[model samples]
Target chain A: MHNTLLTTHYPQLTTQQKNTMNKIQILVIGRDADILQAVVRLVNKNEHWNATGTSEDESAIELFHQHSYELVLLGGGIASDSELKLRKIFTLQNPDIKIIQHWGGGSGLLKNEIQSALENNEGGNFNIVDNPFN
Target chain B: MANTVLHKADTRGDANHGWLHSKHTFSFANYYNPERMHFGVLRVLNDDTVAGGKGFGTHPHDNMEIISIPLEGDLEHKDSMGNVAVIKNGEIQVMSAGTGIQHSEYNKSNNSTVKFLQIWVFPNKKNVTPRYDQIPLNLEDRKNKLQQILSPNPDDAGVWIHQNAWFHIANFDKGITTEYQFKAKGNGLYVFNLKGDLTVDGQLLNTRDGFGIWDTDKVQITAETDAEFLLMEVPMAM
Candidate 1:
């Protein structure tokens, strides 16, 4: 299912073609240590995505400065004010970076959010089979 | 001859990694005790507490019957089979990881911790299609009596699994007595005291204590103090 989605969305990057490209780096920032650990574990399952996570805001910023993250997933554990501040900082550092507020709904939602974010950022309108929220 | 074994609450291996604290009743992850490897077909019993908005990530499993019951707060479950749901207190979730499946669980609350029980039972039928089921429990039915929570028959009372076993839960008042009989031949009951005090077949048990009884048709439980417990009746020999 995941492979099919990627193949459909990115015609230029076929499943076979993906192996030659570098994996997209994802940064997961959260206040809860367990959630950070879980997100990293989930993200690493995908061959096209590499994940790094941190529970501290300062450490997350430091990691962001050191690495180019294609996406940033903010956990629900972060307060609204802090989330907004982080978003501002992220945008200033890399305006094209996709930052999503993750409700920690489940793996399915997380995958969808990542896909949609990537799709929108890349300006692709390829057909998506099921829009679960709709 | 009836045989019984006691597993004290303190004997279980403990693992605390900041955000996740878990107690393993049997060998799991990094904690391995050869003497406590398994009890019959029951391979794992874990008492876990996850900090708010934290939980287990997507992991693969095959040919195992996994059961999760939240004691407090809610848990969000997602699987590669495309099942997404929230299981809260008074609810039971079961997953048959046949032929391999990946799933993840997370605490749904951001402010409160979620405590839950994760149990694994060896499936009698292997290489079948993976399945997921969650059953909501009625609190009133379990008051002072055993409430059937899981059973072998798919059409039987409570949620069903791919095994000839039964699970029951009960909350008792002080001085109340209840008797549980084996539902199948050659079955043993693993009694776990969750809270308060109870005396089972002349043996006293405190919170978190586990007792396995086999070769007996019935076992009597007398609550010395208001108590709550779970009983799992599974085949003595796998």
Candidate 2:
């Protein structure tokens, strides 16, 4: 009854709004909460992309299973073991999923990396930045 | 229908960087083919020939299983883990960059090039610890039969990685035939022809060609001539 009531009360969505709802879902995994939030904000700047951020491996896995993510961005600061586990889990669930390792660069490099990964019609881990910190 | 894909020798991506001449069977650095990214968890298959006094500098990799099989000459390897070694034509080397590791490789000879295969496989387990292993293989064992070079089990035979995969190399005389059974139920097999002509199932492959097959229990391989090849069986779901 509650589900039916909520559904009946839902407002009609316009065609443009419905189209905007088809944003590509992405999962951002990092160890630092601040950086994770910042990366998520950068990812959300794209009109056609939506991102969820997590600072823990467990939460990342939970969110991954809860949503149909097309891409996963692994930010710096994640432990090597955690990064490997996340990669294994994500790939096992969706073999076609694209994963990119996000090293620190400004928002420009971040956007370029995300856009390139999404636009490239290939599947595999892409480590674009090679020691930007250096 | 059974799943199958083929890559002829000439169709592979070629990169001639003077000292380093390489051919990529799958998508690799500066060579991105969406349809040829990977077969199962086999990420990279690079046929590399490094000139004398040239090699890869110290670089870092994590959460990957990197394996190298020398085809000619000797490759000198030095890593941050304090492991310094040389892998020759009859030897294989594997590096488990679990957490993170920096390593460098160079051709040990000053007058000759070192030819080798650089393969990358996605590991099943996460960061355990970095490791390095290399072992000399008996070429006689592969005569007219498959010689195991790599596997998941540490005690089985050859070196081990953190994945449920098996690698074997064989040298068959003309008209030799064999049947290979899948070690795992949901695994796929990638065949790389090193020399001469061969046929897998019903597909013909020439030197330096690659063939991938899945969704089957076994495959029949027949050598059209004196041939050498590598068989890599990897999981399809991961």
Candidate 3:
């Protein structure tokens, strides 16, 4: 989410952020646009997507309540805290929202999807990758 | 500056069909440029903008890691690998078009234009028989955070790319500071700020400003104002 106090003076600053922000009103908290756009673009096609409105992850929760969004996307990788802080906020602020995360070089989600697909569907895209050079 | 083989991509032929406008970052069929082949194993960087109701017809790919990141609007993806996904902003989908695969991308929205970034990376090992995986990210986690979108490991939170690199997205509040540690062994990060203002190690990065820092252990970013940035931590060389 953006700074609430300072952003009032620069209207164009908001406009510039809008250029890269998605249809969802977002606050790129700790992550950047690539991840935000990556998620917003992945979820819904709502014309109102504007995740750039909030510059801090903490502030975006209020924005979500003020309007509404199909999903809330975040970057993974907890910085040594063992437990996650944002996960709890998402659970409390918008329990109805879906939270998607991937960290440790992006390993958790991919692994879960692979395991689930394998368990549920036998013939899926999972396969042993062969050497291209060979 | 971290060591990067800058292949000032030579122009490749493109297709503009009113609805879909795609420009290949590297040489493609009917538009070949050997020198513009690829930067290391980074094969294709296609910038595509699909009209409100237009998109690409069915196409085929093989033995490559295909990643689609929507810059704006929604991208409807249907593949022979039995996957139909829509990837948009802040989201990423990985397709191991191994052996051979057929797929098509279209704009699902009726009135909104769909802008997306499609990238191709060579696999560590090829011929993986084809696969598809998509993940939608949350903005809250990324608030002042660097969220990982793709990597080689399947267990990572976001999508998976076949290369030995990691893609991270983080939007920083003005005067907000953050740090990024290397995600892979012997790998470094390349920072590209698509929008807003950011300073890394006292170096200012504006729109499209790029920074390649390697051999170091971590990267620290402090935004002068509300900013959106991308981080690609890959091998220092091919």
- Specify the highest-TM-score model's number: 2
Per-residue accuracy of model 3 over B80-137 as CA lDDT, tens digit each: 7678877788788888865456677889998999988777765665445578988888
Would you give the TM-score of chain B in model 2? 0.99
Docking class of 2: incorrect
lDDT of 1 by residue, A1-134 (tens): 01100111244767554563478888887554544555677777777887777766777777778778888877534555676667777777887777775432222235545665676531111112122123
TM-score for each prediction? 0.65, 0.72, 0.56
Candidate models: Cα lDDT each: 0.76, 0.80, 0.58
Question: B148-214, model 1: which lDDT tens digit per residue?
Answer: 9999988877888888889999999999997888899899999999999999999999999999999
- Look at candidate 3 and tell me the lDDT of residue B224: 90
lDDT, candidate 2, residue A16? 57
- CAPRI accuracy category, model 1: incorrect
User: Candidate 1 chain A — worst ten consecutive residues by lDDT sum?
Assistant: A1-10
lDDT for model 1: 0.76
- With a 3 Å backbone cut-off (N, CA, C), the pairs that clash in candidate 1 are none
Q: What is the interface RMSD of each candidate, in Å?
A: 17.1, 7.5, 15.4
Ranking by lDDT: 2, 1, 3
Q: Write down the C-alpha DockQ for each prediction.
A: 0.02, 0.09, 0.01
Which stretches in model 1 have alpha-carbon errors above 4 Å?
A1-134
